[model samples]
Target chain A: MIGQGVLNMNTISDKVMFYRGALVPMAATFAYSILVMIYVIIRSSLTIYGSMPKGERSLILWLNGFSVAYSVMIFSLIMAMVSSLVGAVTALILKKVLLHFNPQFQWNKVLIISFTTALALLTIHYLLLRIFLNGYMTFDYPETFLFWWGFPAVIFLGVVVVGSYQFNKALLGQHLKGNSTSN
Target chain B: MKHIKRFVSYTLFFYATTALIYWIFIRPLHLSWGATFKEINKAMPADSLISPNRVVTTRAINIQAPRERAWPWIAQTGQNKGGFNSYHWLENLFGASMVNADSIVRQWQHPVPGDTIYYGKHQGYQTISLVKPNECYSLGGWSFYLHAIDSGNTRLIIRYPSMEVGQSRWTSIYYYGLFEPLHFIMESGMMMGIKHKAERQK
Candidate 1:
């Protein structure tokens, strides 16, 4: 799920901020992917090259490691780009839907809107998988729907709502301190 | 140095959050498909494949093919028969020697309830427990149900209910953390393979 921070865009500057924030998640994903790729290479090397001579093994390991690292880097870049695009679109759709339902923007209403948005995104995801990826939906649709859709929605809303609240508080504190200093 | 620290912190937070969502929410959801509470809880013939104590994971796909067309591909799933329709190279790496059938073999089309479906060399196999021609079948702890959504469409549902006997705490952790995620990759591939094969049948 895209960060709820992305939902606060009101101006071109806010969109720029959203993109800037996106770098955090993208960099995290890239680093994590590289770490996993390295781990996999090491594990596979142990199993496949364990019996080989030390010198030959190290040479093969370095060669294979470099290739895997290269592939991982390329894959991570693609992943970052694709996910950012998806996140942007999801954020836009969510903002639009939230505005439609809760123009006043109560906290409770925001939570509800976030939940609804998440479900909408999940449904679209399921449909896409079915149509394009030949993905299966579970036989027990009700349980699957609740757990799959509900858990992420709750987590996302909690993170966003809380994060935004804390951010606002921090900003307010800074502004108040500035005023005091000026006075 | 401060910027690097912030970057590392941010990266860790992002990674942790994504991982939590995936393990707790996304993985189970994707693995199970859109099964209902009642459908998952209901007893299936495949239940006989294992002792009653187990975790049942069920997934369903709507295929643009009739049940008859889909049945043949599933009926012949084994090492020497029609392959599991997953990653052939990966299977071969694991000593499955899997050669996925491009065309359904006529001889392998008549699997019975007592027959065994070999997964790989060391990978434990599944025993056929139930067979309902063009409708349903159960092998080991997994059951496959083909329901006609319409004249031209079928809902292919696969249920895997495995017993938790002899599993240590570490094994359980490994099962959830690693085995399941890897299993999903192959199983999802198999689901797609079945869909493609059935749809291609004229």
Candidate 2:
């Protein structure tokens, strides 16, 4: 019974690892999408608040600027680190998904997909900044914020692309060896 | 070969389309937001704008002192007051020294319309479009920059365009409310120090 209990614990841990590998990209994508949505809403609200009465408007602008700046810090600095860790861990899980669908299908496609997805996110970030922040033409606040945050966002996207590829390659190379034999 | 070409074409077409759309819509809105923000900021009373525009407080100071006394104080700025002068430090950092680029003396010579000097910074040059010696000092074709209000008793105006990034809002607020007092202390203190030197020499 003690031996059986140890076996069960090992199996459970393996299963957990398997699922974690599969979930990384999806989770990162989900987080990126959610943060973008939040940014969109906040940017819009601040834009509207700027048009109100002078006293009220200034107050709103200050509050919104401070909030948005802080939020970007949380999203980029904190969330990116977490997501990168997730990407680093689950590199092989995507291969399983591909393998299950078609054994011959290459895991390279997952890397391509991740790259395209990261690229799309980056493009969208720029578009949003250009639309809401005015591409550095007018005020110093939004323009300055964009200048500072812009590079980090690019770095994050790059990580997403490269990290996803390495992770997928590593995962497929490792687990798929045994997993493939069984199939 | 045909399939690869088709894929490349599609990717390129999609990228172009999306980029164009983003440029058209997003860029404009961002500009609009900035313009709106500027309007709101400029709407504040001149004085209100002062505290916020500091590091180089452009808000004019109306001094009871004669122009000669004031000029000396202004010229002698950054002499022997702890370390370096506030204006000199500011000028060094932002390069918005009101003085001639060569001269340490930041004086507006009976500045009048058509006699504008460039007050440097990234905000673009401010033309001293108008200057009435000992009476007023205006800049840019529009009436902004330092304006001397009265002769013997002058109102020293420092017209700041807007705040830069990294300049905290709280700093801006603190500047307007407290700067004048600090300025009064520093300038007055410096003046007294200067006066002591002159009087002792006599």
Candidate 3:
């Protein structure tokens, strides 16, 4: 449910990076955020099988469910909004350095920007969890940080890069003719 | 325009058929989610209001906090009190105007049996059937049981016994098709909401 779809190719101005730069990428990031929420919720849920007593597991589940009352996808919305803010700043910096005044949407440049935005999001999540989640002992695995953070980071990179790439093509009136060589 | 119309009709038909099949085939799993056979068959306090031949669904979740810490939250649940611990947005979309509380208000504690549990002006209300501090709580047709697995951990199990109205086809369709899913979503969210408050704080 992207708000508006199929904009006129002429309406989108080149060198501005309006939809190509922000909106589509934000949409993909939003999807990425939903995936992260699902992952976090599921991971928290799976801890029921850990060595912890069933009561503690219930507590974790209760907390996880409460997040659900944050209502099904609202957790994602919160995560998306925060990640988007971080991503917008990262994009601005990346644009100044790599995407400056380029009307031509280089595939490589888009990939690089997506990767960095995902990286920034991943870094923030890692720092926040590291600082706050030490005492409660919710996550038991040693690789909890890398696994949890890494999964979402990988998803963010994949979604934003591919979604932006395709949408940018439409934004700029470029057509992919079956094969990559033709395009 | 014609192509779009055909697509819409096809999608609606497919969804309706699929939903019915799911209700018939996969409904039991959802009804007994995370519950053992023993738990489902076991009698709990909420069974006082349960009618025979009605569909009974039991869902259980684990909590990190002990019953003592979790009891206040379970006690204060009501429309104008702690709220249902469901999606406030969904409730408000139906004009329920629920603002769920994050903290247990000292004033709202101490609910007793026979109290009418308000679910706002927009919803049908359930009366409080049972309330035992740090033990169990049941409101009308649903029951919430708190079992301490250990001193530090608690297992919260909720049983909801409900069924479709037999009066009319429309009522049956509405009950099984729409109401059941919505109840599941809301109730499941409530379970999580309680768990979240208990574990997140202490």
Interface-residue RMSD per candidate? 15.0, 19.3, 14.3
Listed models, DockQ each: 0.02, 0.02, 0.02
- Model 3: per-residue lDDT, tens digit, B18-137? 445454544555577667888888988768688877777898877888888878888988876888876565565444556788888998788988887778644678888888888888
Instruction: List the candidate 2 regions with Cα displacement exceeding 4 Å.
Output: A1-108, A135-150, A174-183, B1-202
Q: What's the lDDT for candidate 2?
A: 0.39
lDDT of each: 0.61, 0.39, 0.61
Report model 1's interface C-alpha RMSD after superposition on the true interface residues. 15.0
Off by over 4 Å in 3: A1-183, B13-21, B24-26, B164-167
Q: Give lDDT tens digits, candidate 1, residues A6-89.
A: 223342244743553354335445665656566656754563353233443554344334434444444456566765565555
- Candidate numbers sorted by DockQ from highest down: 2, 3, 1
CAPRI rating of model 3: incorrect
The true-versus-predicted C-alpha distance at residue A23 of model 3, in Å, is 32
Better of 1 and 3 by TM-score: 3
Per-residue CA lDDT of model 2 for A5-64, tens digit only, reads 111112224354444433443344334534553654465454334333344345334333
TM-score of chain A of each: 0.58, 0.36, 0.43
